[model samples]
Target: MTVDPRAALDRLIASLEAHYNAVAGRQSEDDPAVDDAYDILADAFEVYDEALGTAHGEALPFYLAEEDDDEDDEDDEWGPEGDDSYGDGADVEDLAGEARSS
Candidate 1:
């Protein structure tokens, strides 16, 4: 079946936005969760761009390139490594402790 890459990309983009909204409800844009979301979005676009580069008018499934697989496995799960929110274990509490010591 012939699939339109552009349509697929649009749908992916919409899904990402929805997921971001759900995960970041009531959080400031500067929140680390938001930053992680942007990084995820950027990574998604990079994958799409690479796929487009190799696609010859054919429907290519979007996937991360093996070469780009450099993130720690723990980081692959997304959302604070376990929590539903983002931070990478570097939340405001951690920052506050650092600031107090300095």
Candidate 2:
């Protein structure tokens, strides 16, 4: 079956938003699922940005820098070893594939 990129992007956004909302207004960190969803959404955004030249704006980089900081904080408590939640060197394509399979 063919997957529409736009539809996939929309799904990613919805999932990410839902995860965010589910954990809003709390002192605890975001769920690991939210982080995973964010990564996937970022990947989807990157693909769109590349194909449509939509990521060249200064805002994108600033947003990414902020996200990097958030991710760094998340990394401090994500796994049993306090390391990467998605394992070392796991690319977006692999996560995308897992999402598609599910």
Candidate 3:
């Protein structure tokens, strides 16, 4: 049977998000697969909203930084936070730079 790619994508994303939140937020149990999902979601969000150059909102004119180095302290970090808050502080740009530097 044929399937809608976007719909399938959405379902996959939802599953990942659910599992990721369950483990990361609740800390009920650690699953390696879900850990992988969390990692994948981090990049997916960036590409979907940020990389696409979409505006955050029409009313306010807010935007996501084009470069990770340009990330602000107030903005949530892109990758995993130690305490498991995905929105915690960590500069995505700085993180990217560190990755390249390595």
How well is each residue in 32-96 modelled by candidate 2, as lDDT tens digits?
A: 75566667667666554443343233223423434444444534434435543554555557768
Clash counts for all predictions: 0, 0, 2
Which candidate order results from sorting by lDDT in descending order?
1, 2, 3
| TM-score of candidate 2 relative to the true fold | 0.34
Q: List the candidate numbers ranked by TM-score, top first.
A: 1, 2, 3
> What is the overall TM-score of model 3 with all chains considered together?
0.30
lDDT of 3: 0.52
Candidate 2 ranges with C-alpha deviation above 4 Å: 1-12, 15-30, 54-63, 66-102
- State the lDDT of candidate 1 residue by residue for 1-102, as single tens digits: 343557657856975996678476837646676667666776666655655655654434555545436454555434435454334556656667889999
- Give lDDT for model 2: 0.55
**Which structure is stronger by TM-score: 1 or 3?**
1
In order, the Cα lDDT scores of the candidates are: 0.60, 0.55, 0.52
Minimal lDDT window, size 10, model 1: 77-86
